[model samples]
Target: MKIFLLTEAGKNIGSGHITRCIALSQAFIEKGLYPYFVINGDNSVKDLFKDKKYIIFNWLEERKRLFNLIKTSDIVIIDSYLADNTLYKGISENAKLCVYIDDNKRIDYPKGILVNGGIYSLKLKYPKKRNLIYLLGFQYTILRKEFWYVGKKKVKKNIKDVMITFGGADTKNITTKVLRLLTNEFPNFNKKVVIGKWFRNFNLIKKQKDERTEFIEWADANKMKELMMKSDIVVSAGGQALFEFAQVGLPVIIIAANDKNQLKNINEWKKTGFIEYAGLWKDKNLENSLLNKINFVNNYNTRLQMSYNGKRILKKNGSLNVVSKILQELTNKE
Candidate 1:
C-alpha cells in the first residue's frame, strides 16, 4: 500500500503536524508499506523529512499538483491545520481512503477517518457524520519510537535537573522567558533548554547559557527522549511534547502555546494531576504563574505522583496502534 502524507511545517507554523505525521510514516514503513510526503514547507522544514520520500509544492500557487499524488496513493493522510475544507474535499475525492489527524477541530473534516489523539480527545465534540471513523483520545496518540517504552522517572527531593522545552518552532519564544525565570530561582541546578530547528532567538538563548545551562539544537526524537529521561521536571509547551514527556513519566508544567486547543489540553491535563498548567505564554501574569508552579512542583512527593499520573493516563502504544487500525482498514477493503 502507498500512503501519501499531506502536511506542512515551518518556523511560523510550528512542527507538531509534521512530527506526528512522521510517527505515522514510521509505522507505515514497519508494516511494509510505502509512505510519500506531500509538503509545502520551505528549506528550514526540509530537515524534518530527512530520510523520508517526499515531494514539495507551493500549496497556494500549485495545489493542483497534490491531486496527482492523492490519486496514486492507496491512502491519503492529512495532518495540516492550515488546509481548508475545499482542499480536503478535493483530496478526499481523489484518494482511495482519507484519514484526517486532528488535535483541534479547526476545520471541517472531509468525511473519512478523524483522529483526535490528545488527553481530552474523548471530551471534544465532533460534527455528526457516519462516514467519519473517530479514533478519539490517547489510545491513538502518535508518539515517536523512543517514547514507546521508557524507564520510569525518579523524582528528586530538590529539583536537581530541569528540562525546558517549548515545542519545535516555539514562535512565541517562551524558552528564553522560562529559562530566565528558572535559572534565577535555581541557578545551580542542571538546566537543559531545547532550541528548535526554527527558533530565531538563538543569540538571546545563548546569552543565558552558563556552566549549569546547556542548549540543545535540532534534537531528534531519540535526543529529546534522552533529555526527558535525565530531567526531574520539565517546563514544556502543550503539544506532542506533552505526550512524549508523559510517556517517559516526567512531571511537567505546561505553558499553552498560541492555540486555544492547547489551553484546553493543558487544563484537562491539570485536572488529571499529571501536569500543572502555567497559563498561556502570552498572558501578562505568565511569569508569576510559572514561578508559583515551579515552586509547587519542587516537592518530591508531588513530582512522584505527577510522574505516575502521566504514565497511567498515556499507557498505550499510540503510533503502533493507530497504524494497525489503518492497515486493517486497508486490508479489509481488499
Candidate 2:
C-alpha cells in the first residue's frame, strides 16, 4: 500500500507535525508499505526528506495541482494546521482512506478517521459524524522509534545537569534568554542546549557559552534520547519534547512555545503533576517565572515523584497500536 503524508515543516510552522508524520511513516515502512511525503515547506524541510521519496507543492499558488496529486493516493494522512476544510473535504472525497492527525478539534472535519494523540484528547468533544473512527489520547501518541524504547532516566538528588530545548524552531529565541539567565545565575549546573535548524539566535547563543554549557544541533532521535537520559531536569518548550520527556521519566518545566496547539497540550499535561508549567514566552516575567519553577522542582522528592508519575501515565506502544489499526482497516478493504 502507498501511504502519502500531507504535512509541512520549517522555521515558521515548526517541526512537530512533520516529526510525528515521520514516526508514523516509519511505522508504515515496518509494515512493508512505501510512504511518500507531499510537503509545502522551506529548504530546511527539504533537507529533512532528503532520504525519503517526496514531492514539493506550493500550496498557495498550486492548490489545484496539490489536490490533483493528493487524489491519486491510496491512503492520505494529513497533519497540518494550515490545511482548511476545503482541502480536507477534497482529500476525503478523493482518497481511498483519509486520516487526520489532529491535536485540537479546530476544524469542521468531514467524514474521515480522526487521531488525537495528545494526553488531553479524551477530554475533547469532537463532532459526531458517520464513518469517523476516533483514536483518542495516549493510545495513539506517535513518538519516534528512539524515544520508544528508552529506559527511565535516573534523576540525581542535587540536579547536576539541565537540558534546555525549545522545539524545532525557537522563533522567539527563548533558548537564548533562558540560557543567558541560567549560565549567569547557575554556573555550577552543567547545561546542554539543543539547537534546531531554525534557531535565529545561534550567534547570540554562542556568545553565552562557557565551560559548563554545550550546544547540540540537528539532533536525531537517538542523540535526543541520549541527552534527555543524561540530564537531571529538562526545561523545554511545550511541544513533542514534553511527551518524549514524560516517556523517559524526566522531570520537566514547560515554557509555552509559539504554537497555540502546543500551549493547550502543555497546560493540560501540567495538571497531571508530571510537568511544572512556566508562563508563556510572551509574559514579561518569563525568565524569573521559569527560574522559580526550576528551583522549585529541584528537590529530590519532587523530581522522583514527577518521574514516577510520568512513567505511570505514558505508554510506549502507541505507534504499533496505530499501525495495527490502520493495517487492519486496509486488510478488511481487500
Candidate 3:
C-alpha cells in the first residue's frame, strides 16, 4: 500500500507531529507498506528519516501538490493542527482513506478518522456520524524505536546531569529566563542546555557558554536521547520531549514556554504529581511556584514519584500500533 503522510516540522511548528508520524511510518515499513511523508520544509525530522520516502512542500502553497499526492496515494495521513477546511476537504476527497492526528477540540472533522494520541485528548468529543476513529489518550502517544529501546538504568547510578530543553527554540528566549533561575540553584550540578539551531534567539543562547553548563546545538537524535537518559533532572517543554523523558524514566520539570496549551498540560500533569511546571510567561507568583519545583527536584520522594509517574504514562507508546489498526479498518470500511 502507498501512504502519504502530511505533517509540519521545523522551528516554527516544533517536532511533535512529524516525530510521531515518523514512528507510525516505521510501523508501516515493518509491515511492508510504503509510507511517503509530505512535510513542510527544513526541520530536524527531515534528517531523522533521511533515507525514508518523503517529499517536502511549503505549507502555504501545497494544495495542488496535496491533492495530486492524495490521488496517487492509497492512504493519506494528516498530522497538522493548522490545516484548514480547504486543505482537509481536498485531501479527504482524493484519498481512499484519510487519517488525521489531532488534539484540538475546535476543528470540524466531518470526514475520516481523527486520532489524538495524548492523555488530555480524551476530553475532546466528536460527532457520531463522521466516520471518526478517536484514538484519544496517552495509550497511543508515539515515540521512535530508540525511545522504546533505551533501557532505563537505576536513578542512583545515573549522573546528576540535568537537561534543559525548551521547544527547539523559544522565540521568546524563555530558555534564558529558565537558565537564569536554575543556574544559581544547581550551582555545582552537571548541566546541559540544548540550544536549538532553529531557535529564534540562537545567538543569545550560544553566548551562554559558561563553565557550569554544556551547550549543544543542532544535536543529532542519538546524542539528544543520550543526554536525556543520563540526566537526573529535566526542565523541558511539553511536546515530544515528554515522551523521551518518560521512556528513560527521567525526573522532569515541564516548561510551558511557547503557549498556554502547554500550560494547560502542565497543570494537568501537576495534579498527578508526576512533573512540575514553570510557565515562562508568568503573571505574579513566578518566584514561589518556579523555585518550589526546583527545590522539589532535589528531594528524594518527589523525584522517585515523578519517575514512577513517567513509567505510568510510558505504556502509551501505542501510536504505531493504533495507527496501523485504524488504517486497516479504514481500508476495509467500505
Candidate 4:
C-alpha cells in the first residue's frame, strides 16, 4: 500500500505536527509499509526524516505537485494547521483513504477519517456524519514509538532533577525564561534544558548553563524519553510533548507557549490532574505563577498523584490503536 503523510515544520511553524506524523509513520513501518512524507517546511526538518522517504516543498502553494505525488496512494494522512477546506477536499477526493489529523476543529473536514487524539477531543462534540469516521480522545493520542511501551516510572521522593522543554521552535523563547527562573529559585536542583533545532536563543541559553544545568540539544525520541524518565518533574510548553510526559507518568507544569491550540490543550489536560497550568508564556506574571506551581509540585505526594493520574489517563498504546482502526476502516471499504 502506498502511504503519504503530509505535514509542515519550520523555525517559526514549530514541529509538533511532524512529530506526531512521524509517530504514525513508525506505526505504518512496523506493519511493513514505508510511508512517504510530503512536508511544507524548511531545510531544518530534513534531519527529522533521516533514513525515511520525504520530499520538502510548500504543498499549500504547489498543490499540483502534491496531488501528482499522492494521486495514486492507497492512504493519505494530513496533519496541518495551515491546510484549508479546499486543500483537504482535494486530498480526500484523490486518495483511496484520507485521514485528517486534527487538534482543534480547524475546519469542517471533508469525507474520510477525522483523528483528534487530544485528551479533550470528545468534548468538542463533533456531529455524527456518515462520511466521517471519528477517532477521538486520549485512546487515540498519537505519540512517538519510544513512548508507546513505557515501563513504570520511579517517582523520586525528592525533586532533584527538573526538565525544561518547549517545542522544537520555542517561538516565544520560553525555555530561557523558564531556565533563568529555575536557576534563581531552585539553585540546588539539577536542570535539564532541551534545546531545539530552531532555537534562536541557543547562545543565550548556553551562557546560562552552570554546574547544575545541562543542555540536551536536538535529541531523538529515545533520548527524549530517557531524559523524561530521569527527571523528577517537567516544565514544558503545552504541545505534543505533554502527551509524551504523560506516557512516562511525569508530573508536568505547562506554559502555553503563545499558541491557541496549546492553550486549549493545556486547559483540558489540566482538568485531568496530570499537569499544572502555568499562565500563558506572554502573561506578565508567568514567571511567578510557574514558580508557585513548581513549589506546589515539589511536594512528594503531589508529584506522586500527578504521576498516577497521568499514567491512568494514557495507556501507551495510542499509536498502535490508531493504526489498527485506520487499517480496519480501509479493509471495510475494500
Candidate 5:
C-alpha cells in the first residue's frame, strides 16, 4: 500500500519529529510498502529517506496540493500540526488520515488516528469522534534506532560526566544559561555541553569551555546517543531529548524551551517522576533548582532506581512497531 507521510523539519524545531518519521518510514521499507514524504524543506532528517522522493509545497499552497495527492495514496499520515482541519476533512473523505501529535492543542480531526509517542502516556477525549484512535503513552514513543541500544556506564560520585543537551537550536539560549549557572553552583561536578548546530551563542559557549566543561559543537543522533549513555546525569530541555534520555535510563532535568504545545507535554511528563522539571525561563530561581535536580538524580541510589523505572515504563525500539501497526491497520481498511 502507498502512504503519504507529511512532516516538517529544520534548524528551528530541531528536526526531531521528522527524524522519528524517518524511523517509521524505515519500517515501511522492510514491509515492502511505499512511503512518500512531504517535507517543508530538505533537512538532516530527510536524508533517512534516500530512496523516497518528498514533495515540497509552500505552506500557503500546501493545503490545495496535499489533498489532491492524498486521494492517490492509500493512507495519509501527517506528523505535523501545520496541517489543519480543512486538510484533514478532505483527506478523511478520500483516504485514511493518521495524525502524529505531541502538542496539547485540541482538534476536530475525524476519520483518522491521532498518535503521540511522548514519554508520558497520552489520552485525548474527543466528543464522540468516529473512527478515531488515540494511541497514547510511551510504549509508542517513536525514536531513532541508536537510542534503543542501552550502554554501560559508571556514575561514581563526580565520575558522572553530565551531558546536557537542549534542542538543535536554543532559540531561547537555555543551555548557555544553565551551564553558566551550573558551573558556579556545582563546582564539584564535570559537564559536557552538547552545543547544537544552530546555537547562537557559540562565542559564549566556547569561551566557557575548560577542563571540567567539554563543549561539543555538533554530534549526530548516533553520537549523541553514545554521549547520553556515557553520562550519569543529564539536564536538558524537554523535547525529543527527554524521551531519549529516559530510554537510556538517564535521570534528567526537563526544561520546556517553547511556550506552547510542547510545554504542555513537558508538564504532563513531569508528573511521571521519570523526568523532573527544572522550570523554564520564568522561574525566579531556576538555576539553583536545576542544580538540585542534578544532585538528586545523580545519586547512586536514585540513578539506580531511575534506570529500573525507565526499563519498566519505556518500550524497547518503538519506531518500527508503531509504524508497522499503523501501516497494517491502514492496509486492512483497504
Candidate 6:
C-alpha cells in the first residue's frame, strides 16, 4: 500500500503537527508499511526524519506537486493547521483512503476519517456524518513509539529534578523564561531544559544556565522519555507532549505557549488532576501562576496523586490503537 503523510513544521509554525504525524508513521512502519512524508517545513525538521523516507517542499504553495505525489496513494494522512477546505477536498478526492488529523475541528473536513486524539476532542462535538469515520478522544492519541510502552514513573519524595520542554520551536521563547525563573527560585533543583533546534534565544538561555541547569538539545523520542523518567515533574507547553507525559505518569505544569487553542486541552488535562494549568504565555501573571503551581506540586502527596491520576488516565497503547483502526478501515475498504 502506498501511504503518504502530509504535514508542516518550522521555526514559525512549531513542530506539534509533524511530531504527532511521526508517531503515526512509526505505527505504520511497525505494521511493515513504509510511509513517505511530504512536509512543508524547514531544515530543522530533517533531524526527525533521519532514516525515514521523506521530501521537503512548500505543499501549500505548490499544490500541483503535492497533488501529483499523492494522486496514486492508497492512504493519505494530513495533519496541518494551514490547510484549507479546498486543499483537503483535493486530497480526499485523490487518495483511496484519506485521514484528517484534527485538534479543534479547524474546518469542515472533506469526506474520509477525522482523527482528533486530543483528550478534549469529544467535548468539541464533531458533527456525525456518513462520510466521516470519527476516531476521537485519548484512545487515539498519537504518542511516539518510545512512549508507547514506558514503565510507570517513580515519583520522588522531594522534587530534585525538573524537566522543561516547550515544543520543538519554543516560538514564544518560554523555555528561557521558565529556566530563568527556576534558576533564581529553585536553585537546588536540577533543571533539564530541552533546547529546540530553532531556539533563537539560546544565548539568553545560556546566560541563565547555572550549576543545576542541563541543556538538552534536539532530543529524540527515546531521550525525551529518559529525561521525563528522571525528572520529578515537568513544565511543558500544551501540545502533543502532554499525552507522552501522561503515558509516563509525569506530573506536569502546562503553559499555553503559542497556540490559544491549547487552552482547551490544558484545561481538560488539568481537570484530570495530572497537570496544573499555568495560564497562557501572553498573560502578565503567567510567571506568578507557574511559581505558585510549582510550590503546590512540591508536596509529595500531591505529586503522587498527580502521577497516579496521569497513569490511570492514559494507556501506553494509544498509537497502536490508532494503527489498528486505520488498518482495519483499509481492509474494509478493500
Score each candidate by Cα lDDT. 0.82, 0.83, 0.71, 0.88, 0.69, 0.88
Tally clashing residue pairs in candidate 4: 0
Q: Give per-residue CA lDDT, model 2, range 1-334, as digits (tens).
A: 6688888888887788889999998888777887889888866678788789998776645778876776776788889888888878877887888889987787988776788878778888887787888888888888887777777577788999999988788888888888888898899989999998788789998988889998999788889889888998988887777778888898898888765667767768878889998888889998899889988988899999999888877655787788888777666656
lDDT of 2: 0.83
Q: Model 1: per-residue lDDT, tens digit, 51-117?
A: 8788877664576777765677788888887788888888888877889998877787876788878
TM-score of candidate 3 against the unseen true structure: 0.90
Better by lDDT, candidate 5 or 1: 1
TM-score of every prediction relative to native: 0.96, 0.95, 0.90, 0.97, 0.86, 0.97
In candidate 3, stretches whose alpha carbon ends up further than 4 angstroms from where it belongs are 42-46, 157-159, 282-288
lDDT of 4 by residue, 108-129 (tens): 9999999988877988888888
Query: Cα lDDT of model 6 overall?
Result: 0.88
Pairing residues by index, what is the TM-score of model 2?
0.95
Of candidates 6 and 4, the better by lDDT: 4
Instruction: Find the candidate with the highest lDDT and give its number.
Output: 4
Ranking by lDDT: 4, 6, 2, 1, 3, 5
Better by TM-score, candidate 6 or 3: 6
Model 1, position 113, has a per-residue lDDT of 86
Candidate 5 segments whose C-alpha is farther than 4 A from its true place = 42-52, 94-99, 119-121, 149-154, 262-264
TM-score head-to-head 1 vs 4, winner: 4
Q: For model 3, what is the error of residue 133's alpha carbon versus the real structure, in angstroms, after optimal superposition?
A: 1.8
RMSD of each: 1.5, 1.6, 2.4, 1.2, 2.9, 1.2
Task: Give the C-alpha miss distance for residue 167 in model 2, angstroms.
Answer: 1.2
Model 6 residue 189 CA deviation in Å: 0.8
What would the per-residue lDDT of candidate 6 be over residues 82-157, giving only the tens digit for each residue? 9899999998998999999998889998788898888889899888889889998878888888887878678889
Clashes of each: 0, 0, 2, 0, 2, 0
